[model samples]
Structures are given as structure tokens and as C-alpha cells.
Target: MAKYLMLKHYRGAPAAVNNVMMDQWTQDEISAHIQYMNDFADRLKEAGEFVDAQALAPEGTWVQYGGEGRPPVTDGPFAETKDLIAGWMVIDVDSYDRALELAGELSAAPGAGGRPIHEWLELRPFMGEAHTITE
Candidate 1:
């Protein structure tokens, strides 16, 4: 099986069909959205396709390598940044087609009004595989 990364972005992606932002969603909507994600993960686990997943906070600090003997330089979580990753899921699947199918399903996670978000998910295959670009 090949490993793939499924990236969910907070910004930079096209607006979802259910464009209402999470902050504007009701508490129950938020809970349902979380439940949908958890259920999806559970399904993947049962299928032996799940590797890992995580959600990220919006607050972040950009750290860069500093010259020897110096601490890493840090920068703002700049509000002007074009994109911010909201979360990611790693999956081991039999084929790229399978990965795409899974991502499409995940993009349909419920959002405002208990409707599908229709969010775009970025999928990237890991290196060292024959099907990967590095090959």
C-alpha cells in the first residue's frame, strides 16, 4: 500500500459550497462536524487504511533555521499569509484512485445547516513509491 497525505486548509482553498464559516456555525453544527470526521476516521481504521490524523490551531509561529550558535528565528503567524493548514490525515491505501475516493468523501463532511461542506482536500503521495513523482 502507498501512503498519502490528505490536507485540509483553513484558507487558500476555494470557498466551500456551504460557505458559512465554522465560527458562524451553531454549537450543535460544530459537534456534528466533529462527529462526522471521527466517524470517517473510524471507518478508515476498520478498513486498515488509517495511519494518523490531527487538527491544528490557527495560532502558529514560523521558525527558521538560524546560523550556528543562534536560536531559530521566529516570525508572526502572519495574518496576511495566503494559506493555513487546518488539519491533515495520513492514509495507507492500495492505489492513488483509492486515495482520491477517500479524499472526496472526506470533503463532504457536514458543515453549517448540516450540509456537506464540499471542501477541497489536497492529496499528496509520499516519496519512495513507484507511483510517486520521485520515481
Candidate 2:
């Protein structure tokens, strides 16, 4: 199986996701979202294509390489970048088409109002030395 990366991208500035908003959601709504995600994961597992999946924290830190003898410099939680990645999921699939099909399904994840978020996801194929051919 080949691995593919599904990257999550947000459309606008990072808004504060408040606990109050989450708390205010109807129980059924939350349950439906959970079911959707769970079902998707279960499908992947049943197909034996599941490798690993994870959600990432929003906060990020930046590091810079210094001169040859100097130590690396680190900086924090930069907020200026507009294209900050929200999260990612990695999957092992048989082909590029299969990876794209999975990504399309994940992009339809339910959000507020029981509607699909329709968020954009970047799909990238992982390359490894094992797949290379040397003549």
C-alpha cells in the first residue's frame, strides 16, 4: 500500500473556536458528526487500508537554521501566515485514485447546521526509496 497525506486548510483567518459554541450544539447534531467520522474510519479499517489518522493542535512554532557553528533559533506561534494548516490525516491506499476518493469523502465532514464543511484538502503522495528504480 502507498501512503498519502491529506492536508486540511482553512479558508480564512483563524477564528477563536470557543467551548461555548461547542457546548451549545444540540446533542443529536454532535452525535451525527461523530457517527459520520466513526463510520468513515470504520470503512477504512474494514478495507484494511487504514494506516493512521490524527488531528493536530492549532498552535505552531517556527525554527530557523543559524550559521554553521551557531545553534538554531526558535520562534513561536506565528499568526501572520494565512495558509496555516489546520490538521492532516495519513492513509495507506492501493492507488492515487483511491487516495483521492478517500480525501473527497473526508472533505464532506459535517460541520455546524448539519451541513458539509466542503473544506479544501491537499492530497499528496508519499515517495519512498523502495519505489525507485535504478538502472
Candidate 3:
């Protein structure tokens, strides 16, 4: 099986059908959303396809090493940044199509009013370390 990364973006993607900000959701709606996400991950684990999943906090800094003896330089989690990855799920599935199917399911997560969000998710395949005939 191969591992694939399914990325959920907060911005820089097609807008969701229920495009309301999460902060605007009611307490009940937020609870339902969290429940749905937990259920999805549980189902994936039951199917033996789940590798890992995580959500990132909005507040984070971008840092890079300045030099051999210098301190690392840090920059803002700038408001002007175009792309922000909200979360990701790593799945070890049988084929690329299977990865797509799982990503589709995740994209169907509940949004405002307990309806499917129809969000867009980015799917990327992992590179293998094995030597191939082409090499």
C-alpha cells in the first residue's frame, strides 16, 4: 500500500457551499462538526487505512536558520499569507483512487446547519524510496 497526504486548506481553495466561518457556527453546530470529524477518523481506523491525522492552530510562526552560528529568523503567521493548511490526514491505501475516495469523504464533513460542507481537499501521493526500472 502507498501513503497519501490529504490536506485541508483554510484558504486558497474553492469556497465551500456552506461558506460560513467556524466562529459563526452555533455551539450545537460546532459540537456536531467535531463529532462528525471524530466519526470519520474512527471509521478510517476500523478500515485499517488511517495512518495519522492532525489539525494545526491558526497561530504559528515561520522560522528558518540564519547561519551556522546565528539565531533563527522568525516571521509572522502573516495576515497577508495566501495559503494556510488547516489540517491533514495521512492514509495508507491500496491505490490512488482509494486515496481520492477517502479525501472525498473528508470533504463531506458537516458545516453550518449540519449540512455537508463540500469543501475542497488537496490530495498528494508520497514518493517511494525503492529503486525502479527507470532508475
Candidate 4:
């Protein structure tokens, strides 16, 4: 089986629904949204295709090692960056097509209003030394 990475992307979800912003939703609505996400993850687990998943913290920076006696340089999570990754899921699948299908399903995860986020996901195949070959 080949390993694939399912990357999650969101423009600015947290800002979209802050405490004040999400105040527009009732408690029942929030509960339903949470339930939908739990259901979706459960479905993946039952399918045996869920290898691992994780959500990332938003703060980060880029650091560069200094050459010779120069001081190391550090940059930041640029505010102009539009393609912010929210999370990722790693899965082992038989083919690229299957990986793509899984990514599609993940992108349909429920967001506000029980509607699909339809967020953009980057699907990448992992490459490593081959251990075996078959004819």
C-alpha cells in the first residue's frame, strides 16, 4: 500500500466564527455540527482507511540557520499568506484514485449550518525506498 497525505486548507475559519460570530448559532446547532464531524471520523475509522489525523496550531515561523558566524534569521507566518493549512490526514491506500476519493469525502466534512465545508485539500503521495517488488 502507498501512503498519501490529505492536507486541509482554510482561508480563515476561526475568524469566520468567533465567540461573538458563532453567537448567531443556537446550542443545538453547534451540537449538531459537532455530531456530524464525529460521525464522519467514525465512518473513516470503520472503513479501516484512517491511519492518522491531526489539527494544527495557527502560529508558526520560518527559521534559517546562519552560515559561519552570522546570526540565524527568523521570519514569520506571513499575514499575506492566503493558503493556510488547517490540518492533515495520512492514510495508506491501494491507489491514487482511492486516495483522491478519500480526500473528496474529507473535504465534505460538516462546517457551520451542517453544510459541507468543501475546503481545498492537497493530496500528495509519499515516496520511499521500495522494500519489495512483484511481477
TM-scores for all candidates?
0.90, 0.74, 0.91, 0.72
Per-residue C-alpha lDDT of model 4 across residues 1-135, encoded as one tens digit per residue: 788998766554334222233357668767876676667678777878777888888777878998989999999879887767878888888788999998887767555566665666788888957668755
lDDT-superior candidate, 2 or 4:
2
Ranking by lDDT: 1, 3, 2, 4
Tens digit per residue, CA lDDT, model 1, 96-122: 999999999999999999999999889
lDDT of 3 by residue, 1-135 (tens): 999999999888899888989999899999989998999999999999999999998788999999999999999979999899899999999999999889999888888888889998999999967767665
Give one digit per residue, the lDDT tens place, for model 2 in 18-85: 21244566788788877998898899899888877777677877889987999999897767777767
Q: Whose lDDT is higher: candidate 1's or candidate 4's?
A: 1
Worst 10 residues of 2 by lDDT: 11-20
lDDT of each: 0.94, 0.76, 0.91, 0.73
TM-score of 2: 0.74
lDDT of 2 at 80: 71
Please say which candidate is ahead in lDDT: 3 or 4. 3
lDDT of 2: 0.76
| Better candidate number, 2 or 4, judged by TM-score | 2
Location of the lowest summed lDDT over 10 successive residues in candidate 3: 126-135
Clashing pairs in 2: none
Query: 2 or 3: which has the higher TM-score?
Result: 3
